[model samples]
Target: MKAKGRVLIIDDDAGIRDAAFQVLSREGYEVEMAGTAEEARRLVEEYEFDVILLDLKLPGVEGLELLQEIREEDPQAQVVVITAYGTVQVAVSAMKLGAADFLQKPFNPQELRLAVSRALEKKRLTLENIYLKRALAEKEGQVEFIGQSPAIRRVLEQAEMAAQTDSTVLLTGESGTGKGLLARLIHRMSPRAEGPFVAVDCGTLVPTLFESELFGHVRGAFTGATQHKIGKFELANGGTIFFDEIGNISLDIQAKLLKAVEEKEISPVGSHRLVRVDVRIIAATNKDLREEVRAGRFREDLYFRLHVISIQLPPLRERREDIPLLAEHFLKRYARKHCKPVEALSPEVLEAFLRYPWPGNVRELENTIERLVVFARKPVIGPEDLYFAGFEDQAPDLTLEEDLPLEEVEKRHVLRVLRACGGNKTLAAQKLGIDRKTLREKLKRWGVTP
Candidate 1:
């Protein structure tokens, strides 16, 4: 295997430095050693390393102080503390200060190698996540709103306008219509954009842990509550709190949440003092809260409080015009992510995109593009490269039914086949058992442009 990464060892003890150097070098790393923090700082200035292993009991510029200096120089740097068994507290402190890992003194060679490898892997993943986030931000302008239908355009307009407001916003949409993305856009564009935007999926939180997570808990509040904790609401005090799938939360939790929203204050589970906070709440649900309210499944008062401003996203079927744009965006993203050279989508592939009534919306489009990018052999994704075999059973109503007009049914079937194939036309015609030229004429007559 190729060399993984570089490692820097800073230790006052010559024996420990030599041992670390040998272990790390054997594990396919370019290893560097320093006898003091001053020397380590000089080496760091000269070159970047994937991991830094520092001894806490150094003679000069003791470990924690040097760790602070290293952080001040490069906040992204991964530093692992080397502590004695008795100095375990110091090691834990180092971890709180952003140290990647700790190695107790007199550790086995295998343990040292594993710790170094884990630290390097963590650093690598962190850098990769940062890069992915940057790329996602750059691509945001390409397909910010992923549909072309008038209904979708109206929804986009409402979303853009709602993003400018500080009032509580409610997003109602089908399960896969990209409600979460709209919520993120709202937070990103709002006045509190610089502040933290916390997202909590209410559907996933356990009933018992809900209050402590939302309103926080004082130390000794419950059996496992050993330390004071700041909850999601406090974390988003000056920013935005996104309550995803709010319809799934229980009535008991809703009552507590309602009080927090109305009073702008939250009392920790074990505390009498209420903490005042300013937070913008953004709630999302696939279920209609109006029906939920009448059914007594959701709080009526809380629904009105959250519905101060509302935006509804249209399904992908309503935005067929946006399919090509969304497909291209996802294609480019997945191609770059997987390091593939795949280029444009074929005409048939484009047709397939425009025909499918995407029940899963933009997410399904993205997944299909990623799948094609990974499996397609040609530089240009063709009709044959697009796959839609399973969608027939999965989407029964979307398949051409016997009651529909033959011409209209043919048009719908062709589009559905093409979309399932990622807009590939040749394969769509083959699936339809018609000539490519005939398919082209039918598409033209149907006013379907690839």
Candidate 2:
């Protein structure tokens, strides 16, 4: 889809405003014009523009002062400063005030187009990065992991301990068990919390482009290497780099990564000079890295480096007592997001959640609750909304052994309930309308516990 963007032009001279309007409008932007800094400030108060062409010399108010006002109002607005031949120093000062680019008058149409395009592209990328970071933050905070269960308490203590160290950490967990969330928590609690926290999913990167993206490349490094670029290591210098699914990288890339980690420096492709960086590494994987090392799929030396502080996140099924707390958390979040008034879950729904064995772990439960909140016709979520699919074939031993057909249904339900509770068996049993002892017997018989 083509992105819709608005452009604001501010110039005292009528001729300059008209020329800018014509050029920007022709480039598919919705254009707005202002003759003075006062008019521009009024327009800015009423609306937001993707890019603003600001004249350095205004009639009364200076351009640099207006630039400061615009920045205070909307920091994300991209401003391009216009300057005359003798006023280059003013344009340089404007750049310090957050001007995205500068155009010297009288400028050609092609130069104007190029500067506008570059500024808008930069603004778009910045907005996208902000959106992704906000989404990741929401996901990380949704599951609080509160529990008194021995297994869960131990995991929390280990997490706290890991947060204090600068050594590389390796988090192993089943899919949806919140490995990414834990990585973020560790970074937030560390000494480098004020620095950047960059997370990358190694599985999503193509092998051909992986090297340039991770360590960067100099100009002319490859066919499309039009300019020198700073890679993730440079961007995340003096901070932490969370490598999600690190096992997905190829052996060639792994060796390069090991050298960078060990030497604390990176040499961009096509450049002999090395750039020194101080970055803490946190690696996570769902697969068994030791097996990969033994099979020669992963390097033994790299495996040892990443496993300095090892942590294994327990799956939802293993810590069934925490479900109700998690479910309530999800319910409140989804309600706020969807503008819903749903206040609680029905008894039957809570029972089903506690009985279900959540093969997909915490993420699946969060998704299920969000779905329930969005589609629920009533104020409370009930058992009818619970549907567990795709697990029928794999766990026949567990499902078929139960006399009740709803046993599989109940298993799905109970697991969801426990996850909602953050795996607290007493609270889960209470939510399930059963006593703690009865719940314990059922868990023992069903081979599920917290």
Candidate 3:
């Protein structure tokens, strides 16, 4: 898949603009150039850019002024200042104005590409981080999720299809498979891109406050209701409300949600008035909603409503071939973040990454890369660094813990290995230094079947 990013190059010099454009375009980036700060400002206003290369000196307005304007336009745009060798001070000043990084005037192709890559990587990570913060709250997030595998591409295709409609969408996947990221992407691609995006974690909401939190409440609605409160649906009016971990909500709340979803209207707690809302609904859950419905925990009506257009994100293990791409993306990100001199992961490190099952998925790998960058001893991270980064498969032996019986410990270790290897018994057995037959017997004793 092509990189989903645009780069803006603002330089008065024709040669510099052409050179930068050529380099970025060749790297699969949509490159736009501006001869002056005015043109650059227009483009910045017209389009969203993942990275902006701003020359320190422009013809009419100073580049620093343009940088400030760009920050004003979109504070999240990654602006990288371009300066002559002796003008390092000016570049430093640009950074204070929200410039992401600085590049020397005579920088080589490698430096230019690396700088742009790092900036774009940062942009991608920011999206995921924002998504996670809204959905999971105070959790680390994944970076660039580019993958050429047919599986991931299919998921993107499904997302694009879902984006074309105002119908309810249900995204199902393993945790860290980036369901929240996909939800935001769908919103951005939809007609409501300019509107607010309200994300609610059903699992995080208190059961007692679920109805009021989702449907708003009037003044004196309850003992604690001192004033009127606007809920998520009202906040997401004219936009989208992402119901993350949707299966965790109570059936009582599900009935209320179903009525509001169907009618596009809600009645506040202790209020007879019906408030209409024009909001798109996108629900996500790691749990199987079908199972929840069958178990009577989730309302079948609500499940049918949300299961309109479903997209299933493939787990990281199913697309191991994409590990290197993801790893390199995160490596550049955290390296630039911690101001580490690290450049890339060594081949051995990539091999180790591919070897690991990544049971915790993309979020696990992203966090590991950040930690590795902080403690990296060299410019290139190898297997030793990967091991130090805790990529090795070493779970605590339950037998060694206090009051743990040998049989219980063995069963727990087997289950742990099975989970780490993504339900592959052969691989789990190999990692445990046991044959498949022995692992099967051990698992059978734990009431697990192949």
Candidate 4:
């Protein structure tokens, strides 16, 4: 069986170490015993432990000093100090030095396990608080949809109704059509609003590390895996896990994912034990999954499983009526973000925006508006400024030349977008509707420093 948690028992007394190891091992924890402070330090450097049992008196190094060192290495480390009888004051000193709790020297198996459990709980809570805080901060201002078009209203209606249920949702739209944003909105409005919203960018995931990235791995599971790590599915337990660009995942992964989606359980990379997860699956894909299934690129079973409820987001061009509102929205946001006095777009600029194909959709429009806001020397953006921003000239031309290799065309287009974004990689990636990592990888492959 997979251990419930990993633990380290450090004590100079072989008898006490053996007793504690037997007790914890029986309780289903992976227990390691260290007879000295040096041995304990070696183990600590090698693997991560959920809890550590440290005897207050050890050879060579003082227990309190070792405890301080351990805490220094990992401030979140949970250490339960063991002290001799009537040494409660010494234990109190250990606590002041970052020890989580204390165990009396004559502690029985029950007392030993209880202390470890409390320490593990404290560690879990501390990590959870940190994760939730970071998640919440990333989610600020991300849930709002900025369009009022009928097409948007329809999508919003479906999303609202879908949020109230636990059913899986498949969001289909062109790239940069706000599928991710809509997914966040659904999560925020759902019953699990308080739970974490974890998003996995399927397109950016390396095929080799995909499984471990999604399902986690145990310590020493594979090369460079030095510690047990939780995956996105587990991290999203009790909440939603959004699989962005889901159609990009390969067939082998699709097979493994199918079982998890069906069973709501995941097997970590090197473990036979299956972990049950309670996560609402919200999968977004720019690809036509139906076509992908027919083409044998996507699994039919997974497709049907993920398609319990479907919401299609209209691309920005299809909802051109909302372009003015969206433009204003992005303008105000970037104006405030860059501390610019730019407030609105000129009539000609808005007309040009309406006429552009916007292959990158809302994201492209947003980046263009932000660039205008940042570079605008006056209160209102005019056509003359659009010339400098290159929106009118560098807008991607979908038309392909017969002799131009697709790769060359792509390189030119990406470079153009990057130039238009003023060499801002983040803005360039957003304008191209790809993650910054993907953009960096592409640039690296193209012999460009990113």
| Residue-level error in angstroms, candidate 4, position 222 | 1.3
What is the per-residue lDDT of model 2 for residues 1-450, given as tens digits with 9 covering 90 to 100?
Answer: 232467889988899889888887788887889998889988876665778888878888877899988875556579998867436677678888999998988988889888888888887677447535644674544425555567677787888898888999999986678888888878888898877777777866778988898877767789998866657776676678889889989999999999998988777776564555678999998879999999999999999999999999997777777888788888999999999999998887776677666655777778778877887777977655544322223233333445656456556666666776789987766555443554565568689866
Q: Rate residue 29 of model 3 by lDDT.
A: 85
TM-score for every candidate vs. truth? 0.57, 0.59, 0.58, 0.68
Give stretches of model 3 more than 4 Å off.
1-145, 393-450
Which residue ranges in model 1 land beyond 4 Å of their true spot?
1-143, 388-399, 402-450
User: Each prediction's Cα RMSD?
Assistant: 17.3, 16.4, 18.7, 8.4
Candidate 4: tens digits of C-alpha lDDT, residues 8-126 = 89998999988888889889998889998889887776555778888878878877899987875545559998868537678678879989998887888888878999998897687
What lDDT is reached at residue 53 by model 3? 91
Candidate 4 regions off by >4 Å? 1-124, 133-140, 394-450
What is the lDDT ranking, best to worst? 4, 3, 2, 1
lDDT of each: 0.76, 0.77, 0.77, 0.83
Best by TM-score: 4
Candidates 1 and 3 compared: the better one by lDDT is: 3
- Model 2 segments beyond 4 Å from truth? 1-148, 387-450
